[model samples]
Target: MSAELRDRFFALSTGGAPADEVARYLAEVDAVDTEPAATLDGLGISWHPTVRFKAVRFVDAERIDADVRELFARPSQEAPYLAAVFVDPRELSFRTFENIVPLDRLLADTPLDLDLTRRAELAEGAYSFSLRLPAAARGHLERLDALNLYVPPLNSGSRGGERFIFHSAQLAEALTKAVAKALPQPLRDGFSHVNPVFRCNRFEPGDANFHRHRDTPYYDAERHHVSRYTLLLYLTGGSATPALDLTGGVALAEIEPFTCVIFDQRYEHEGAPYDDGRKVFLRTELIFTFTESEVTHDPEIGALFGKACYWTGESVFAPELARHADAYYNQVAAAHWSALTPGADREPFVHKQFRGVHFVANGYDFWFAKSDKLSLAECAAITLLDYFNCKLGDTSFRALCQSEVIEADEADAAAWIPGFLQDKRGDSAVPPIDKSLLFPEPEEANNECCPFHSWAAFDATRSEDVIELYTQAQTFAKAHILPAPIVMLGEDVLLDPDKFVIRGNSIHVLGKESLTPVNFAACWNAGGLPGNYIDIAATVDTAHFLVPPIFFTESDDCYHLRFDFFRNSWMVKHQQVTIPVPMVQDGVCDDGDPYPWRYAVDEVSLFTDNASDRGKADLWWVDNPAVEDEMRDVFD
Candidate 1:
């Protein structure tokens, strides 16, 4: 009797019969055989021999509690039972049928223009589209108690599909009741909801083939719920050529239409290729949430899990960094709390906190130091607290946490104040200090180059000076220095400065004018600020600075500013009068070397072929005319 029913069902499914006809035949098979697994075996539907199987007809949600209990009663090494088939397609109503069938038709009719150049980059020949189900369809699925079986809408696209997420209270209750018994002791009572999102796939038989892969767990946008299991439902089935192949040599041939397979996402599986027919499936996930106690095993420690807040620049860091910071803080907090427990695992906690400190320190050093938006002292304090908490042993850490006072010498701030300022002034040529060195690491006690000891010694003798220098250094680093200005004569012609010399009041800039642009053309000069002169001098002498303006006649465009060597003034446009050199000069240093002077030019006018456009041949100015007054004041 089972063999006859199976043959009739297969013929109806593969012979282009309506889905309702195949569904009606399966309902008839369900009427004769009460056992789902026995019916499947009798009908020749194969599954993994080692995998445990249980089936619940979609219409019989009331009986799920008893069935789930019976399935989990047997001893199983796997945390969750392998697979559960939601059988009997009779529950797929006409409304659900209308929502699904038209999507396949739309996908077929839509014209897809595949980029031939990117053929290798495409995912096989199957195209994917992100779509949402119609409001009416969602309402009908809810009314039919078929929310779990809802299919998303289909549209035309090139590759990769989008996830559709929707909430259904009825589906959540059914899933919770079904998997409640199988959850671990801690997670049994914490059942949250079935993942509302559906991962839909449409595979055309000669074009679509999925390689052997394991699905990763899904986390919701907020990360409050995570999926441990994958729910796969086949809406249409044809062609036995491509079987559902599992890791254990189990190949399910001709999986009946509307058969929903629930399995662990960790299971490795693939779809074999077929020469004919198409397969469409919708994949959803079962999501669960863990409370603070369940996650950290302690209520007090769990309180800190999601509470730590860190500052991050939206433009500077990746968007995911904020989420990662929350997770890392929770992990580190849990480890720290666990270490404080009596007779708890100490080494692992210490190691975790140590690594976490480095992460926090590096993040601040590389990113936050440049912006100076986050407080470095606060970051250092947080890291120091973690270090002391983990390495100081349970008793001492506990005492410190309870606010017990520890004796320590207080250094006099006045002692190192003068010397620190003098050292900073003397060492103005030193390179920029790495801000991360301010973070102390006591673990590397034996390493001579470790910054912890150096920092500690500085703290004792010159802490105030270090703080002052750090503030100034951070400010200095944030200043924006402009690049050398470009002088363009018409579109393609460029005035490239080869050499610049200042004598008295006139500044002479000598360079070649090229019709074709040169790779490097800017006139660079040795420049530095008083505070950072030493550091700047250590590398290249040239610094980015503004050039002074040069006024020239159309007939004498080649004549540039001439610097008077004796009078320290500038002669402009061959004028006999000398303009006092506009330069800010610092007095001679202790070593007798004069500090670099700074000046700027407002505009450098040149006669160009198209200078007549502005109605003046000699009035053509450089790119930036806004600084003309400032440049003129240098000579004034």
Candidate 2:
């Protein structure tokens, strides 16, 4: 009987059973089971013994249906949607029940600054302050890696009083595991992780109350995850009123401390103003990713191709390219062409073999000879015609060539006809082609080579050949194509000479300059004095200094230069060794003055000794001679 109950409990816990059903079943298990706590713990339920699960169904059917339809329309597979679930706290019937850890104990060592001056002001009269804490505070929770605490900048309609937001990976993981235990098998399988960032709202009596508003879905690009539901963990209790007042006369009034309310983000809800006492609650999001198997079943080739193209220019491309490359290639190669779809316009194709050829036209235009110019597109089309003819060995190629879409220019068509006809007829007497006639060297002014030029020369017969061509194209691009020049600013100021007059004491930035990783590394290893710039010198008024090479790291949002002097030895000894990039924020340095005017610095100006020195004029020894002697004594 006990074994049967265990199986049923496990089935209900993981099988996406309704919360009410699971809750009722837990009661039954508790009544009959000898070790109910052990059984529940073994199944991954981490809630306190006093907590009882309850489903809070909203009355707004229209809104719920709309949300469901929207989720269904998403390209990725959808997870189960629960309108709301109320985790009610009940008096413990059993003896020696384990109690939840006190919130004060959990936040004992955490430093709190209640100053609202520096905090970001929100809608209504609400304001907040935040702090970042290590995950170690919540001991035993392995998934909580880091915590970021801040008050959320709520949307216009929503308003709340002073709230401290806690974004903790540990809390997210703990909640995720607990939630997963109650989810159906399909949803459990699709569950990725809970959003680490959760809002901790503290609304005192007479504080700004939240107005009715729908939550916008939170998207995490880094995780490729989205929040479908909002989880509210009520931290403080004693109020008779429900914390959340929803649309359509429904109210979630379970004001018991530790009672969690999980609801869909689509629900229009508001925190009703309470004058009786304070209300504190933790609000977090349940995040999930689309299953790979589902996404792969009917992949969106166009979107994937677009993403792949964007990734090509990004610093981090390898992982992203690898993800979509195979799937995109497979879809495109297997696609059959009958007619051109709407929005079929001339654009560069992602694939190398199809470069220059109209990607849209390739879908419906069966004919090889369409355009008049003997350009790269024409060459590629002709090559494709020959490849298909050779591979299939039939009249199909000829039939396609004579299709209704064929709009050949008689003069241009005649140029490649002889060689094409010779190949088709298996004729050996085809003369050695004058390569210059077909592909003349472009003028020096227009000599910018396409990264995929090499691939155009080689005919791709199979997917492997296409892959090899892509590899070659990447190699060519890395070798020949220089990325857009990184603009290194001297300080926070713009360095356009036309916009800002070049002053006598200011550093004059020339045009943009590109720095390869090799150049940057060499400069850093050689202690800011690269071999190429040994003879170069820059002068500011009467002072002269060797131009320091600038280095920076790139992220998804912005670029940053490390300002740590210990990492760069030259910076320690020379006051002039500094890359004056824009400061991320306005701040007063130790000297009790605002930062200097930021300006752009050109690499050539620095290397050619044209850039002015704007650093401190006094020597380090003059300011701190005793420190120099102490450093020498320590070293000696």
Candidate 3:
């Protein structure tokens, strides 16, 4: 404590303003103690201290601690946890957090969960690494100015200096408190109450870019301590550069205030450099290990949690959803919309060769059954398309679909895959998608007004702007040719109907179900010919041709269910069904995982118009003899 004001603060403490008040003040001072003092030395801890805007030495710890507490106690309009002492730079670097983490104990305690295995191989793998955020938490992480730290030598001829400030205390405190509360148990003890490893970093605007590498808990070359899951909390500043370019991984943008980019360390990754001036990103990373044994799972273990597989209603809030519902709607409208709304352009749908053309949208399985075997890539693709379709409507939506994406598939893969695989093309971080799987058959869209750029249009199509989607779809399936379909036991779906679309490219189905009042599908075949159909399927997504047979059943959770492909919105259609999740929960796995699911879809046949005497059911069978043989081979 400085002698000049040491006596003043000391005088206040001894003045006896109020007995209770004195006690509270002292307790507040005590709360921040020992930790900061220890940070100075004794354990190779790297830290800087300040008292009343002045950098102070350890001898003045009491005064420094008291001042910081005083600042913290003041109420702010924003979240309190956000209020913090920001070092000039923003980085979560603290010595205790790094050296003392119980790596071995944590690893031994946690288990590799097999919940997803039970859910289905694909769904299980995607959900294993995916995490969700509560609405408030997500909001807090997306908003601004927060505290950070800074330290560096002075410019030439200037005196060396060190300082810190409250970048945005309100925002910082909110983040700190939210994180403290949201952390899983193992993490709570390591952070909020008492932390063993406290490595914090102050991310300033001038930090060097990161090499594509896994984060390591210990500075060993092996980097084995890279935790299975980690959260990079952004407190302040702007950062970009080594934009996270992990292959097949969720592409993460630079440090944004309030946002915490959670990720798996096993993936190959990089953080863009801090090139923006003066921005500070107070960053913190929390990693924990868990195996199958630590947490146990039981059907109805705790209070029976409610889950909805299909959002039966609408509200301002985001509902849970499947990955393909919205994309499916766009694919349908791309080929069939003109039939309902004359002159609608649909070149965008066929050209992109969306990853999953024929897969059932989530609403179908969500309301009718429960299946999580969807891929993250498919989910993200649907999400982007869903957003455009909702905000832009048919014209702009079509425009965007044809407009060349500014970035490449791999460029944005971080959000979809673990980083271990991001491979870039040339100097750009995004790599072009191979066009092999995405193409149309020979005939293409027959709409006379639609632009016919060219057949085998490679260069322009490679960019895959909205217009090119039409070209790609044509390459996949024209009137003259169609790709073979995948056949499995007990089920057969028409890969490419000989007559898909009647006028432009479209497939016509019988039954009022396809031509509901909403007209999501073109089922009213003006020309009553069983062989006439629209060629609307995208090669990348052959399943695009058929909507799942909608059925309302118990969504595991036993909630009321509903699904409509046109109601495409992120998380809007998702409903959790808490059925009997038969996961590999207890015997030898990480039990912390939520229950997984397994599902079956079969007996698919198209409805056809036939008088009662001619057929038992008015329908046409997709006679792929190969389908029956395949099914027998698979499940036999």
Q: Which candidate is the best by TM-score?
A: 2
> Candidate 2 on 286-391: residue-level lDDT in tens?
7778544432322233333322222222102123333233333233322211121222122221211122222111221111222232222223223222222211
Clash count list over all predictions? 16, 12, 124
Model 3: per-residue Cα lDDT at residue 114: 13
How displaced is residue 570 in candidate 3, in Å?
Answer: 43
For each candidate in turn, the TM-score is: 0.24, 0.30, 0.22
Computed on alpha carbons, the lDDT of every model, listed in order, comes to 0.30, 0.31, 0.26
lDDT of 1 by residue, 1-636 (tens): 544553463345234788888677666655663333322211111111111111221122121233343331211122122222233222121112112211121123322221111111112111122222345433433222222222222211112222223334444444455445433354445456666444456555565446455454544423456565566656555555445665653456766444555554545567753345556666677676745454323333322222212112110122333333344343433243244232212101111112112111112111011112222222222232222121121111112221111111113212322232222221111112332232222121232221244534322112333233223322322221111111211111111132334344333443222111011111223322232121111111111222232221111111111111111111111100001111112212333222211111111121122222333222122123332333333324
Winner on lDDT between 1 and 3 is 1
Poorest 10 consecutive residues by lDDT, candidate 3: 575-584
For candidate 1, the lDDT comes to 0.30
Better of 1 and 3 by TM-score: 1
In the range 224-265, model 3's lDDT, one tens digit per residue, is 121333444444446455444554565545544444454444
Models ranked on TM-score: 2, 1, 3
